[model samples]
Target: MKFVDEASIKVEAGDGGNGCVSFRRERAIPFGGPDGGDGGDGGSVFAVADPNLNTLADFRFTRVFRAQRGDNGSGANCRGASGHDVDIPMPLGSMLFDIATSEKIGELTRSGQRIKIAQGGFHGLGNVRFKSSTNRAPRRASPGSPGEQRELRVELSLMADVGLLGLPNAGKSTLLAAVSAARPKIADYPFTTLYPQPGVVAVGPFKSFVMVDVPGLIEGAAEGAGLGIRFLKHLSRTRLLLHLVDLMPPDQAPLAQQIRTIQDELRAFSSEVAQREQWLVFNKCDLIPADEIEAVVAAVLGDLDWHGRHFVISAVTRAGCEALCAQAMRWIESQAPRSEQDLMDDEISAAAAAAPDAEAGDEDHRPA
Candidate 1:
């Protein structure tokens, strides 16, 4: 049940059965012709997305997967039994890649979705197939073909409607815990939440949106600082981003500069992600002096050249949290239903296109 987001594995398809070479021998017939049957085809390897799964921990222990080999052909023109296929179950939002070629195989975004990772070998031909008028009672038979083998990298990204972005201890976990059933580890210290946590935020009856709390981002996060570039790719699928800023930080690095630092990191990560719809959220309002709250908000807005929607809330007290959730739900509901598969495909294609550059140490942040 441990949360494992990434894993590597090798898969091998089943080998086809060998063909039989035989001729009929009957008392009534003087000369018998070739009557051997063809061999059975090998089994294939497939990966299936299951909604019940939320992690890739299952792949951690088992790194090698191989399908069953087909049975050998029998005498008297009897075909061999086909091999059983191997199915690997993974969580929804799993992305598969070819490690050697760096090719994007596919992404699983919906329940029951499946993709063939390796193809089975073809069955061998029997002597009966080689029999003809030119050569009667042929004794020729073809050997079975070998199955396909591949080394793959599997990574999981949690699917959500809204993503929380901010520096460490910006109250993202508290917000998620307050609004939904997800119970993330909470502490006053930074980096308390190491992994992504998902929750269902309900707006009304039959109206809800998923929210994801990603790990904290440091100033040089795009350059592999802090938690490194491991979890940033999870933000690509989010429709809206909530940029949380601590209004009153004990460290006293100008609040405006802190906001800018996060913005710079976002821009450095990906321009496409930077241009996504983002709302400025000033958190920890309760700690801010009553008279200085407005001044601080105005100063931060001016520093960022603000002309967009913003909010001020305290995640611990649940102050303004409801409104924030409401607004998030409204924005999510307004946007078109972006196909999860299409988005994942785009990400994979982008990664594949940048593989060469990545190999050359191109400082590009890609999902591991």
Candidate 2:
């Protein structure tokens, strides 16, 4: 399936049913009172996250969604049935936004998580509700309110533990294939991998992490160059970044200069992403003579003033790939948990902390 990261959709909630204003007409009863039943509430619209889905292509064809209207109220105290709610299945990690106000509704980060996009209209009142001592035979009934309608912008951000970054033909896909089971297209020409591909890299039994490989970036990528920065959002949730560089390339630019170009583009795209912890991985080390490898690595590191961890690997030969994977797993494990459990706990704590303030506000508003 063609990966679609963004899409626009229209959602309409069901409208409430109209109330009835009828009086009971029983046999031998001269003063039959009002016994009209109330109308049922309308159905709402919600967006649910589906783990099996990874793209928004399904929403492209079906751009509009409308729920069922509520049933009308009946006489003799017979209530109407409510309308059924509508559930929209969207990919996990999808963010919803209001197109008119550009307000962020919420993001679906967990499987089966749901967020309400539109609310149903309230039910109309019946004549019985308005009946009082003076107005025993009330004839007026309020009409049902209209449902909420909204146009939403859906954007998907991939969830991964590690992200790959580099220029074209830098052996990123090769490294991914060597370390994991993902088989992205490999070619000598640039732009072979047109989209982002995620793979699971297992360091050992019961120890693994997800890694995502996006299309290689180039100079002026932030300014809509080759492939642009469209796919970069896939890395927004990643904890670590692995920057791949070809040890030997056809271009005459220095290795340090090549690295700097990618860095500038990354910073241009997202400053927060540029602040992520990155490790330099020089690929195709087998092409360089063994004795000159150390000197070349040293020169590039010194020229770039890099102080972080670096690795020399041959992706085609699977050399040094194991160590890289192991280190990545360890680093990911060392970081703070980004799981749903922690998020839920934080929310609970926040709500608990706010309970006292709510009580205090109630006390302040109490009758004196």
Candidate 3:
């Protein structure tokens, strides 16, 4: 439960309740005028989403929240009590930014949703609401309204449909622990999967998808280098991008220059993630050498000049891992009805037909 994904918090919202004044008298009634009362309407923070939360680590160490302060008016008119709203929860995707003008302010991503943010404070006004007739001993009242702080930040991401990419120990946690149910933390060394890690796989009888693994990405990972650019916003909601590679590399370079240095750090982190729809696998292949498996898969696909689809699996002896998980569930059921900008234009035309000669730069790995 030490995942975290990101946080910041502050919130606050709930502070209106203060308007009594009083003035009724008794013993039959001496002049009974403005009975005052009227104040109570504060308490709103919200946030929700909670699919049993995945982890923001409970906002780290409880980063201030607030909400609940109304109640305060009773005199003979009575009318207070309305605060209790806080909510918060989070998890299912999160996002909500705003920490001083970063704006965005929304994005729970389903699982109950909710939102609000902070806005509760407006309930003051008593003295029988300024009863008049030339001011009948009024004496006004009002004094409450003040709740709506903020700061926020959140930022989870994780939603998936496949998005492994590679570089360090390019086995993507042994192909998401050999096809889903996620256990992660496999190690042969090299950044043994640090964060992200979702799973779900299945492909029939109620078909499934979600994949994500994320973590290992180097060569100036989108600019902050190793584990930076915060796991590239969990691969911008992924849609497909396996990538892997390591066609046998104890680091003797040349698996086509380590697949062109992970396709030049994924087009230097974001040419729409180097034009998604990746797919290329070729993982451990049982560490190559079975009579040089067809000459190391034909010299690593002719020096990484790769063409289109490619597989070779081995995620720890599941060789050809079920036809690379049945051809990645048939290209995620044929791009599950496209649109994510046509699956990022079919992953930048399959990364320009698998690195046509590389170089499709322009940078902007998103997530400023």
Candidate 4:
């Protein structure tokens, strides 16, 4: 199935039923008061997260969704039945927004998570509700209000543990294929990957991580120059980013310059994303002699002033891939969940640190 990450849709909730007005008549009784029933409430619209679905293709053609309308009230004190609610199955990690106002509606990050998109209209009041001792046999009946309607925009961001970042033909697809079972299109030309592809890399039984490969970026990608601009948001959810650089390139661009180009584009797109935890991986090492690999790595790191983790590997030959994967697994495992007490301690420490500065500022503002 073709992967669709974004879609526009319209949702409407059901309308409430109207109230009824009637009078009771019998041979034995001389007069009977109003005997009308109130209308039932309308149904609402909801969006449900489905873990089995990864694409928004289901909503591509069907753009409108509506819930069932409520039944009308009847005489003889018969209340109308409520309308049935409607559920929209959406892919996990879906974020919904109001297209008209550009306001965020909600997000579905976990499986079976649901959020209400539109509220149903309120039911009308019956004539019996307005009855009073002073004025009996009232003939008034209220009409139901209209339902809520909205135009929504839904976007999907894949949930992955690690993400790959690089320029076109940087051996990102090659590296992913070597480590995992994902078979992204591999070729000698650039831009082989057009979409985001995810794969599972397992270090041991019941121990594994999900890695995602997105389309390569270009110098002007942040300005919508390449496909990466469209898919870069997919990496926002990842915990780690692997920046792959090609050791041997068809073009004679400086290795450091190539890396800088991607860095500039990333910062331009999102500074927060650029500041994320990233590791450098120099690929295609088999092309260079074993003795010279260290010198090349050192020079590149020196030129870029890189201080984080670095790795040398040949995706084609699978050399140094195991060590990289193992280290990645260990690092991922190290990011354990913090306890509630730890969070509370951190908050207290932050507040205490701020109190002194706040007092010093107040003293400066005070009159002598």
Error of 1 at 78 (Å): 1.4
Better of 2 and 3 by lDDT: 2
Q: How close is candidate 2 to the true structure, as a TM-score?
A: 0.89
lDDT of each: 0.88, 0.90, 0.81, 0.89
Best by TM-score: 4
Better candidate by TM-score, 1 or 3: 1
Each model's TM-score, in the order given?
0.89, 0.89, 0.42, 0.90
User: Candidate 2 — which residues are off by over 4 angstroms?
Assistant: 338-368
Q: Per-residue lDDT of 1-368 in model 4, one digit per residue for the tens?
A: 76788899999999988988877777887678887888877889999999889999989789999987777778888878888888999988899999999999999998899899999878877788789998798999887777789999999988898999898899999999999998888986665588788889988888899999988888898898867478899988888999999999779789999999989988998899899889999999999899999998999999999999999999999999999999889889888688999999999999999999999999999999
1-368 per-residue lDDT for model 1 (tens digits): 55688999999999998888999999999788888888888999999999888999878789999998887776678888888999999999999999999999999987899899999988887898898899998888887898999999999988889999888888889989989999999977655468999999988999899999999898888999988768888888788999988887768899888888888988888899889999999899999687988888998788779888899999899999999999888887778676999799999999999988777775455456
Candidate 1 wrong stretches, greater than 4 Å: 338-368
RMSD of each: 13.8, 10.6, 17.8, 7.2
Q: Which ten residues in a row have the lowest lDDT in candidate 2?
A: 186-195
lDDT of 3 by residue, 169-196 (tens): 8788878888778898875556657788
Residue pairs clashing in model 4 are none
